[model samples]
Each structure stands twice: as structure tokens, then as C-alpha cells.
Target: MASESSPSDPAAWLALLDWRRQISALYARVRELRDSDPPAAHALWQAERNRLFRAHSQSPLLPEARADFVSLPCWPYDPALAFSAPVEFLPLERLDIPSSTGQAMPLVRFGRVELPVGTLDVYWIDVYGGGVFLPFRDAGSGHESYGGGRYLLDTAKSADLGSAPGGALVLDFNFAFHPSCFYDPRWSCPLAPPRNVLDVAVRAGERAS
Candidate 1:
């Protein structure tokens, strides 16, 4: 763990703040352009992510990995894999999910979303300034994607893709990404729970490199 006097501590916090700001801005543009040109919006998203991974101070890649980084191993953008799914509200049930930091995060199961392939529980951080959280593991996990899983919406850090006119959450699998913990264990991230694991292979997101 980094100490308060460690030079990298402050820089890491500031870099993470900047990273969140950039991510929110990127998603804002995605919401605007996704309707008119899905492919172009996807391209913009991928290019910006590549830039962040390669150049951003808050990147999860190690020094050696960043030195030779080119692009994330991702499946091609497929429109069919994207959807605006309606939320099915459930009786609020609370659970604590273990994190990579060895601490548990309090989460409330507020709803569930049914995709064409399977269903996923939608959670809300049961803490101050709550934000929606949705993480899932597919059949490809441990082989094609991270063994723990990937995140679709972690609004606490401003990783949101926006909502539809009918109030459905815009879930674009092409934009799905591995958590920071996937690359570096220094970061604390919540892993997907048992109910959120899907039986189908979701082949349109970031893959193991």
C-alpha cells in the first residue's frame, strides 16, 4: 500500500480523477453520436480507450506493458450485440461483494435486465452518493475475457452509456471493458456475483490479450 508521504500517491489520485472526467466526457459523446452513426461512435470510443491505455497516467497497464502497448484485444464492433434493455425492478435485497482490496462493498440488488442472451442483476452501491453497478461474467470468462468478469455500467466512476427514450439502459457489449483490477491488482474492484454469470458466450467485447 502507498503511504501518505509517497510521491506517487497524490499523483495517482489526481490521475484517477482526470481519468474519470475523460471517461464521462467520452460517454457523453457516445450518447450523442450512437443514434446517428453507431459504428463511428464505436470507433471513437475504441480509439480514445487505446489512447488512455497507452498514455494516461492512471492506466492499469504496468510500465513494461505500456511500453509496448498498441491496442486492446477486442472483438469487432457488432451492432447486434448492443441493446437498450428495460430494467425489471426487484425487491431490494442487500449483499456484500468481496473486492480485490480484501474489503467488501455493500450492494443492493435493485433490478435485473434481461438481454437476448441472458439476464443480469442490476445493483446500486449502498453507500453515500449511490451509483448503479452492473458486472457480468459470460461463458468466455477464464478463456477469452478476464476470469473475474467485465463491467458494463459502473456509474460511480462515470462509466455510463446513457438511457433510451423509453428509459431502458443502453447496453453495448462492444464497449464492455475489463476492470482496472484485470490489469493491476493495486486497484480495488467488485467482481461479478453468481447470479450475474451468463451461460452464453458474449463475443463482442474486450478479450484476453
Candidate 2:
């Protein structure tokens, strides 16, 4: 079940609504621009993400950290990291995922995709309404990106980047991003499991400076 904000905190409710709208807009723009201009789309997406993290009222950053925020350090767009992979659905199985906050969320393993990096299992979040969830960690995790991992697709919160024709999902590493917990300890985000960890160094996504 989803948590609810206090009825007395109207500001909190408004902030949550604003965040949902912003995320939806970002994903929609990505879907529109990726086909024609992938590089441009990536650049714009990064800029918008920076703006949200730095300027938005409902940013995930801790209150004390926002003042010094400039932009998230990210690697340049690399076309080589983008690929269209065929999804192989696994027999439906639910896995209980432990969170940073000690709560467990159930995610159902629905499919797998083989990419240049490796084969990765795709999970469907087991909530009121289901959504795809893809998180990964690479060799560059501790040094380049967040130590835990980064998110490639978390459609539950509108981070989808769309798919290609012929039933292949567009797995773009250029769009891989850090979870909210990277900035604020209050947020409990799901990390990439052992199966999702790639042996290769994915040096094309968002990194820490």
C-alpha cells in the first residue's frame, strides 16, 4: 500500500503533485525526442533533471545540500551504450526487496533482456498498479556513479524512455540515473540486485563528481 501525506500538510500534497507532473513531462519529452535526435534528447533531459534537483521546491536533495547544488555530474552521451534488445519473459515470480528504510516491497520477475553488457531480468512492481522497474550497478559504481547503483527504468514514477519496434525495449545507458536515496537518507530506494549488476563498466551514465 502507498503511504499518504497528512491532511494538514497541504504544501506537502501540492509538492507531490508537482513532482508527478514534472516526471511525466520529462519522460514524455524523452519519448518524443529520442527517435529523431538522441543526443539532443539526452542533453535536454540532463538539463531538466539538473533544474529539478537544484531549483524545484520538492527536490530530493536534503535541505542543507540544495544550496551548493550546481548540476549532477554526468558522462557525455555515448551512442554505443544504446541498444534494442528482445525481452524474454520469465515465469512469474515475486521477490521481496528490502529497502533502505527496512521495509520490503514485492517485485515480480516478468522478463529478461540480453544486451551487450549482459542478460538482465526485468521486474514488474507488485503494487496497486504495476509498473516496470530496472535498476543496475556496474564496475564504475563506487568510483564513477553512486556506490549502490543507478536506475535505468522505473516507470512507476514515470522514468520510462519508451521502446523500439518488433517488441524490443530500448535499453539506453545514457539515461541511467541515481536514485533519490543518493541525495537524501530519508528516501528509501530499491537498489540493483545481484542479477542486475553488470560485469562491464558502464561509463556513459550519471556519475558523482
Cα-based TM-score, every candidate? 0.93, 0.94
In order, the Cα lDDT scores of the candidates are: 0.86, 0.85
Alpha-carbon shift of residue 65 in model 2 (angstroms): 1.6
Per-residue C-alpha lDDT of model 1 across residues 1-209, encoded as one tens digit per residue: 10122335667777777988998899889879988998888888889999999999878788789998999999988999999899999999999987766678899999999999799999998878789999999999999999889988888777788999889999998888898888887777888899999999999879997
The numbered model that scores best in lDDT is 1
TM-score result, candidate 2: 0.94
- Please give the distance, in angstroms, between residue 182's alpha carbon in candidate 2 and its true position after superposition: 0.5
Write candidate 2's Cα lDDT for 9-97 as tens digits. Answer: 67888887898899899889988999999999999899999899998877888888889988888899999999888789779988987
- Total clashes for model 2: 0
